[model samples]
Target: MKTMEQIRHLYSRAGFGLRFEDMRLVEQLSVKHSIDFLFRSSVQSKPLVSVKENVNYKDFLKDDQLSRKMFMMQQRQQEKDLNIEWLKNMSTGNTQLRDKMTLFWHNHFACRTLNAWYAQQLNNIQRDNALGNFRTLLLEVSKTPAMLQFLNNQQNRKGHPNENFAREVMELFTIGRGNYTEQDVKESARAFTGWGFNKDGVFAERKFLHDDGQKTFLGNTGNFTGEDIIDMLLAKKQTAHFICTKLYKYLVNEVPDAANVNAMADVFYNHKYEIKPLLEFVFNAKWFYNEKNTGNLIKSPVEFIVAMNRQFYIDYQNPDIQIQFQRALGQVLFYPPNVAGWPGGKNWIDSSSLMYRLSIPATVLNDGVIDFTGKTDPDDEAFIATARKEKKAVHTRVQTQPDWNKFLSDIPAHTTKKEIAQLVLSPAINSKLLSIINKATDIKTMVIELVSTPEYQLS
Candidate 1:
């Protein structure tokens, strides 16, 4: 049986699994001390944004047509450059846990950055509210400049309401659909009237455009504003249950057992929607350390990358290569596939992706390269020529000097391939794959094989 501390470390490192060092320390401390340390230390990662630089809402609309177009173009360029810098920060950030949790919130309240400026704002909001209160996080995200623009809440008005934000708030964020009615959505939409981004892409509530009229939402009638609507929605028991159930799937296992979920809901609801309290409850619970929960989840691409980075203390000096590396392996920074975010676990593996994931570590470590040239046709001369050119580019331009010594030093010397495989992969391993690994002459080959396997996708 895994120690409670080891379980925490596994959960943190693997699927936000705990760091082994943290686990060791926690074992000597009280649960209260351990829980406090996790949260307190988890937020050590400095945000990409700083304390100054006020975002003036009026700045958004100052540019005239020619200037506005020019500004927008400039913003795109800035974002491209900024993304590389942010990647560097994420790679070397002090607070790995906070960055990881911020990513978790990003997927939960999904937003796509169409432009650079809005995208940067979206990223900052995620970092700001990552370890904070759930209510505050929800409110900030709702009123955020990027979110308002993304969800079409900027178009919400008293007379002509846009229901996009309201619909998502129910379906994706708060109640997860079926819990709210069409009438409820319609009413909630009205409450959010005049919630929009200003000229500077900062949140601004337009009073003249807002609907102050009495509205009925979820059987409650009043002169409700957007905040009031949020309050009411959160007050619902179903909201607590929804959030708790999702947390179970994320932190424990993909599937939620009824008894576990209900127990979480009871604690979450009783605490007036405090996330930290509920997390403590879950972490302290016996089921979280159950053998079934161990190594059950497949690490998301980000999780996999972060865990590897953490384990090896690896840092790439080139931001572009690091950023491009993730893009090649899938899970590009700041770019989620859709509002639902990356479909994690088994969904991360397919023929195309699995090969890349398997090859990426060696590629990064050994300075290997992959040709993206015309590998399309079996017998096309033009494609063959393109493939040759691309291969040349890969060999020459994407140059890297892999350090095997560092990689070897990172893992235990006496650790068998099977033990390392269990550390990296999940519960089950294929016998055929195991046989292939057994044939690997050395640790490096064995490491590559384990990572290359279908099982490595799991935590």
Candidate 2:
């Protein structure tokens, strides 16, 4: 049998932590088999279909402020719906690794758009390329309408080049900051001039608007197009190192081991930036399963909520309640805070956010309530506004009852609460919390008590 810690660590990294049935299944497999299973399952995955909302923008395109406002409001609601669909997939989809890696790439190439169609399309792009080669993913993302619009690349032209996309391509997406100079950004922008999409959300090139001139980028002088610039960037070893560092932090631990990152980069670069092999190398590494890496990173709001849903099979009668919970927890899907996306880790937790996070399991599983009326930071007012706009009662309550029979049946009859605790939590349970949990009368109460502890916050 796989050790409880080994199984827990596998689920924690491969996807969210396992439910009881998931644990039972994983217990039968060796670690290598488990990793291979996740990869194979994800590779065969299909794109997620977002729930369609029937809203005709043409009806509201009357060239008036009220019309524009109505259109925007409708789009915003549709975006929320799309987010709910993705959340549902993450919680229950068979291709768990695809969903997890899509989330990783979403933050990596963070771009926000109010258009629901663009948002849905962007999500598909992330999913499609989540396990593919990095070079192809980079090129596809750069050409997408949502990304071009978000970075103002559509405004770029031959004489007046907008450097926003080029700058981020290096600083945020590729080799990272300080690896390339400002001159490189300017030259790269020139090469990327006329890179835009048509109104039908199709990728189109405007040859007349493009600048065809020799430019020096990274000490190489050539008449480079946007594609050429991307090709050159991918050729650098720094790009591999930068990407590997991010993958390490996301999958392994927040504080990356430089040597491990460098080793992974070698494999990544040698294989021409294919993501699957890099992931395989990471999972196969001896250090990845080290005890020090377990429970080292804090769970982001999305991870926390999705894992809870996966474990308990949660659903909200009013879908808006799900959106409100996400907002209150500080991660509104399809609406990243900025271009850099959610900082995650320590940034995900604070006095207000942590209280909200801790209360989620109880609120959903036990019919507990939440109060939002209090003095708060200006930055958080947006979430409060989103909550207020919801037509349903804002106070917390369980809308859908959980099906616990499967989970209960999966556990052995002789298993104690301590053994259950070990399976549920990644970090070792604190003695004080364990003492309190040991007094619980039954398994249900024990679960609630275990999940509510601070230890549960670190997955």
Candidate 3:
């Protein structure tokens, strides 16, 4: 692969896509230097805090007369603001890989919560430990208030053990399904009983409620605790393989390359699940830049929004439009479809969503009309508000200001349409598509036209 192609592919998979500011610097270096640059630059990540004022979560718990309707309204608004803020964060800055990886882990360890404080804490945790260590990330995610409440681990207790938490910890989070048996789930559930959060949202064990009985799990017999079960899961090589394969699908291609994934698995296992090294290995590999793997994967809804914003150097006039786009495209932030998370790949391109996905660039850039007639997420207050506001209107405008001049300044004067297409798209367009793209009068027009096409839907 050429250096530029490799760089674009790496950035697309590693981060979002190459930023205009990084263009000059990246052009001077090879793929290896770019890999080092990306890893080195992401050593520190900025935290996302939508709620500036801290509120005591326990205060709400203590209030006996707190109105349920008022609480739901507050919770929904807080989460909506948070969702938009994170999308805005993802759109700008040098924190592409860090923020992008956080998005990956967000879906990987899916948890839903009404408490915005707990949600913010969990997101920052993912960002902080995104490229650090899988062991640390897994442990922290497993213990978070969001996860505990989402999986009903807070209800787990002796003689009334909730198997929901234990089953997911094994089947979804750590090792994939089939690595353990039903008996393992039952035993592990007993071990995890009494694992609940305190009033302050801290992990606390209800000692009296815990079943401190000796149990056999995954062929090991002992008086195991929840922490012990986690340790045992990490010890299994299959855990590494499961995570690696999933990563391979996300970063490389939807269809995993078994040989390359096995190599990645070895690195992840031997390095004790060090995320940075495993990703470095993948980015450094020649097979990762192969033509077959270049642009086959469809862009997830979040990725599409981020890439568009970055490419245009866009600033949304109404940031709430982000949640609209997300809801329309079938991947709202902070809201996974279920415990298993959003089923990515082709699932992102259903008949309803694909039309909106293709029309997004035009809607955001050209002030074109955008309709949210596809589906409505009743859980999101912002979405419902948007729907109600525009219910009678035929053409609702997407409020965004794209700085095309600033972005166009970054493009070299000598660059060809073909090269520009390669930078914006994954797979090369056909002759007919090229003829269509050639109709644009200027570079900005060409780009706006390109992004509006079906080919631009893939990253």
Candidate 4:
């Protein structure tokens, strides 16, 4: 039998944690076969549907502030709908690796837009290229309306270049900070001028707005276009190493293995930034299964909620509850805190957030109620104002109910409370928590207690 720990680790990193039925199936396969299965399944998954808004841009452009406000409100509603769809996919999508990698890339190439159409387009681009070539992904993202608007690249012109997009492309998205000079940022921004989108949400370059002058970037002199600059950046070995280090920290542990990352970087760079080969190398490495890496990372809000839904089959009668939960936990989908994206790891937890996290299982699974009022950060006045407009009061309760039969049916009769606890939680549970779980009268109570423990926060 595959060890429970190994199965848990595989599912935790490869996708969301597996359900009991999935675990039983996965235990039958060898580790190599399991990894292959995930990649193969991911390759075959379909793309998410694009957002279709009924608002007319021409009408909004006219001199009427009320019409513009209505358009903005429609976009906001569409964004929320997209968020709900994505959550549903993560909870039940057949292709787990695709969803997981899509999330990774979303944070990696973080951008936000008030235009819901552009947001959906960007999301689809990330999903389509999540397991594909990093170079292609990078280029596509740079040309998207959502990214252009978010980074202020639409304002870039021949004589006046905007450095926001160029600076972030290096510091946050690629080679990281300190690897490139400020002069390089200035030159790169010059090359990327005139990159903007039209009203139809299509990328349209304004020829007159582009610089078209010779520039020296990263020790190379040329009349480079935006694409040329991207190629130059990807040509550097530092870019490969930078991406590899991030992948290691995200997929393996917070503290990356230097030698392993170097090897992975070599593979990634040699393969022309194909993401699949690098993922294969990491998953196949024997060191990946080391105990030290298993539970070293804390679960982000998305991972925590998705994993719980995967196991318990939570069905929220109203989709707005998902948004409320995400807001309370401080990781709103598509709406990151800032340009740097969610810090993740330990940043996901504070005293207030932790208590809410711990209370989620009991509140959602047992009582089927969640009070949205006062749970969110009081400082988010914009969100508060929006909530009030939507009539989402403090007394709002989630009409959530768990399908316990689906959860319990997969647990074998011979499995003990401790064994079930091990299956549900990542890392080892503390003695006090274990004692509390052991005192439960049956499997249902044991599960609720186990999920309530701090150990459940790790994976």
Q: How close is candidate 4 to the true structure, as a TM-score?
A: 0.94
Q: Give a tens-digit lDDT track for model 3, residues 316-412.
A: 7778878888888989899898999998999999887888888889888887678776355577546468558654423467878998778778878
List the candidate 2 regions with Cα displacement exceeding 4 Å. Answer: 1-4, 51-69, 374-394
Q: TM-score of the candidate numbered 2?
A: 0.93
Q: Put down candidate 4 lDDT per residue, 1-459, tens digits, no spaces.
A: 235567678878989886778876777787887888888878765655647653446666975887777776676778789888898999987789899889888888878776677878888899999999999999999999999989999999999999999999999888889899999999999999999988777899998899999999999999999999999989999999999988887789888788999999999999999999999898888788898888778888988899888889999888777888888899888988788888887898998789889988888888555566566544345656875766344656667879999889988878777878877887876788778776889888888877887788886
**Model 3: runs farther than 4 Å from truth?**
52-67, 380-395
Error of 2 at 66 (Å): 5.4
lDDT, model 1, position 5: 39
Query: Please, what is the TM-score per model?
Result: 0.81, 0.93, 0.94, 0.94
lDDT of 3: 0.85
Off by over 4 Å in 1: 4-36, 50-77, 80-90, 325-330, 373-442
Give the higher-TM-score candidate: 1 or 3.
3
- Candidates 2 and 3: which is better by TM-score? 3
Model with the higher TM-score, candidate 1 or 4: 4
Rate residue 223 of model 3 by lDDT: 95
Off by over 4 Å in 4: 1-4, 54-58, 61-69, 375-393
Clashing pairs in 3: none
Best by lDDT: 3
